[model samples]
Target: MNLYKPTDERIWTGREAGQNLYVYQKVEQIDLELQNIPVSGDKTFVLMGYECDEGVRRNKGRTGSKEGPQTARRQLAKLPHHLNENTAIFDAGNVVCVGDDMEKAQSVLAEKVTQILNYKGLPLLLGGGHDIAYGHYNGIKKFVDNDQKIGIVNLDAHFDLRSNEDGNNSGTPFYQIATENSNGSLDFPYLCLGIRNDANDKILFERAREWNVKYIESELFHKQNTSYVINKINEFCKEVDFVYLTIDLDGFSSAFAPGVSAASPMGFSVDIALVALDTIISTNKLISADVAELNPTYDRDDQTAKLVASLLHFIIHKVSLL
Candidate 1:
């Protein structure tokens, strides 16, 4: 689709780092139309950016993730090689949000993601907003068999089950997903971890219960009890065939991850979050994933961006071993 703008402004980097070459110098990127994209049998990743934050604006939160995709690329491209095995990664370009039309942008993302999944490549989206979840799920749905169960796990401060009663916004993606799942034959096994009670209202909690969503609060999954949370997630993963993990940067403490739309002061610590992430990866159930809500304009010394790059490196390295 014309909505996709493919540019290599940051996908290339210097090779002076030797065997520790960054992804930019090694990864293949798509600079052509989505229809002409090729499939690779190796551990292929199709990285797409949802460069729109209209959903964040509609939900009355900070907005700047439109630059998230490129920002992440800039970071990922230059990271030291960490993978244990050879892999193929692609930069599929960004789905731009023009004229404040987020719906169209999401549609384009869905189409692009579907194409990648169809080619047997895992789709790893860079955040524009949590609204990217709605588009991300749609694309996965298009590629999965009708009978395959899809379980979604969100690592965020809020439940994101806010009413679409107002309209489609960042806080309404999971609620919208629930409604869609209810109308279809697939299971709605949604698990949200690291949620902060203060970040969501009573009504949102009620909505989560109504949707039969399962969640683990931040207080219960802090640094002191991450092992417990890992056990919980492993049990949750037992119910589905495919897993999609989305990490909203705001789920981390503002001190650790200040570059988000809604920074949380008492959120998960880096160690706790990393343990949870590593445990999830170890489960070997993850099919696709994305890191959302990285607002570069609000970052402190690029802390959040670097953290994301670190997580991406870890995930890629682990997935390669699997």
Candidate 2:
């Protein structure tokens, strides 16, 4: 818990241009430790950052994603506000990873997430790496009853179901979740979209099949099967009591998301990704979500950061309706 940093008031700032109200003017910094903050019968959202890329480093990928949260905040702050005046949106700050202790960092993140969920506040996590998913899922499990069916929907170019044999890393989060499911925690109903064939190995596919994970390959997205994908997402959403959505930026084409830990040339486009995201939001089953793998070091002119911010803005706007 010592690793948890309370929200910084300085990160939200923007030029007051015209009649537009931006997120910087609306977001409030709140203590995650507080219990039972009054919500006005509306969906409340809390934003937290996981400031650790140790998982990416362990996976031998790009190493600068530790700076992702701050950059994402800066971009998000400048976006025009879309939620109502009374909407309870708070910045809960970051979970810092000191030294190379990734497991401890994840444990701390899980605790923080559980704290937010304790008050029925939905978490919108800004990741330090895809490994954030493991901690995110654990937190949700802690809050939701074991009898409730929680489904995971990941939009990523890779399955991320790699064995954690060497140890847990960004590539092993889903596998960790699968292992937990195998231990009889709950039935794992996972739907992975935007899977690029070249990004994953034969062994990964074998593991996915062995685990009975349902996936929509990147080729399907490229072929413009929007209706089919939407139907699949709806079906997945209908079967779960709660949905945990994780968006890995690398799932988008390198042209749209070149600043990720792993950029794939054959990934899907932004428009389709947006459509899929909107479809998920429409389900009213989404309980928590996160945007992962935004490596600012590899970003071009902050394009990826803007894309990340825009996605968050869209989420906030749509979720406010539900």
- lDDT (Cα, 0-100) at 178 in candidate 1: 84
- Cα lDDT, all candidates: 0.83, 0.88
Residue by residue across 185-281, what tens digits does model 2's lDDT show?
4246999999977999999998788777889998897536889999999988998999999999999998899999998778889888888889999
Displacement of residue 268 (Cα, Å) in model 2 is 0.9
RMSD of each: 2.1, 1.9
Residues 1-322 of candidate 1: C-alpha lDDT, one tens digit per residue: 3678885665556456656467775677685374555655558777888888899999999989888877877778777775433577777788888967888888888888788887777878898899999999898888889988888989899889887987899999988888877866323789988888899999888877776788999889777886688888898889888899999999999998999998878988888877877888888888889999999999988888888888887787777777
lDDT of 1: 0.83
Highest lDDT against the true fold, candidate:
2
